[model samples]
Target: MTRRIPIIPTAIVLIAAAIMVRLGFWQLDRLAQKQDMLARFTAAEADRTVHPWPRGGIAPLGYTRLQLECRSAGPAQPEAGRSASGQSGWAQVVQCATPEGAKARIVLGWSSQPAPATWQGGAVTGTFVPKGEDVLVYADPPLAGLQPNARPDPRDIPNNHLAYAVQWFLFAAIAVIIYALALRKRLRG
Candidate 1:
């Protein structure tokens, strides 16, 4: 007669399978959310054209109720850096104006890290993006005028969840295959 296998090991396998499947589903859910956000942003951009003023500034970023356009684009602060490719780099978001102008705003989000600040009266050209909950505009970036508090740092770290989800699913598939072969051998006799 063949010795019996312990139940504890079987239990462990079942638990692992459950955990991996759950993780895969979680990643999928996050993916859906990201897609939805992308859709909304696209629609907003399409619905309206960036309206810039020849000699005017836009309403504060938080005040998305207003839409502004760019008459003259400021010096292209070429964003340079490497974080996650496709979305990486940092540059100033300057809206041409003097020190007393209320429209020297920017369309850049926020960053835990700070970038260089240069407030030299230059030029600005970009569309108006309604600030979202995740968007954070720096109110003060060392420079007062000629430089926007928002710096363009395109190196937005991408989500690694999809990779993680794939790994988890692969683990689960392997577990199923190994356990099935073992169980088949045991029962065949």
Candidate 2:
């Protein structure tokens, strides 16, 4: 009597392996894209050209230095943050109305206490750091007698696609090996 391979189980295993392999390739593509983005950010940091505060989206202006006149400012809100010296502290942030009537968040400075800083608003210059849907302007000289907030650096952003790709590929190889071993054992039995 001849033992035949189980068709359904083999097909399922193959499909799963193929999916994993595809996912690995996708991650590789993401890795390339991330590298390109980081390169652009690094170049932006070296650029000293200060641009007017963006009125709309801030994604493309990330890492670029910007100057804006704060027509008016709201109350300051101190959030947990880090100082430029790598010390744990609170970042004094406030919503300010620009000359263009656009709202912008300014990281006035850092403080050891959570007490909000007093800043009426004035001409501010800083680098644009993209955070989620919003952008934060980390004041270069800081404001309200508070400590300096950490400057934005492209290196701070993590690029883990390579590791993710390796994990997916390993999972695919392991799945194939385990299925082959199980099938061989069944045939012998």
- The numbered model that scores best in TM-score is 2
Query: All candidates' lDDT scores?
Result: 0.48, 0.90
RMSD of each: 9.6, 1.8
Lowest lDDT sum, 10 consecutive residues, model 1, at: 133-142
Off by over 4 Å in 1: 49-90, 93-117, 120-164, 179-189
Could you give candidate 1's per-residue lDDT for residues 57-168 as a string of tens digits?
A: 3343322222233234354343443222233445344454434443444433222244544444433334434344232223222232323334222223255678878988
Q: What TM-score does prediction 1 earn?
A: 0.47
Per-prediction TM-score, please? Answer: 0.47, 0.91
Off by over 4 Å in 2: 55-59
Clashing pairs in 2: none
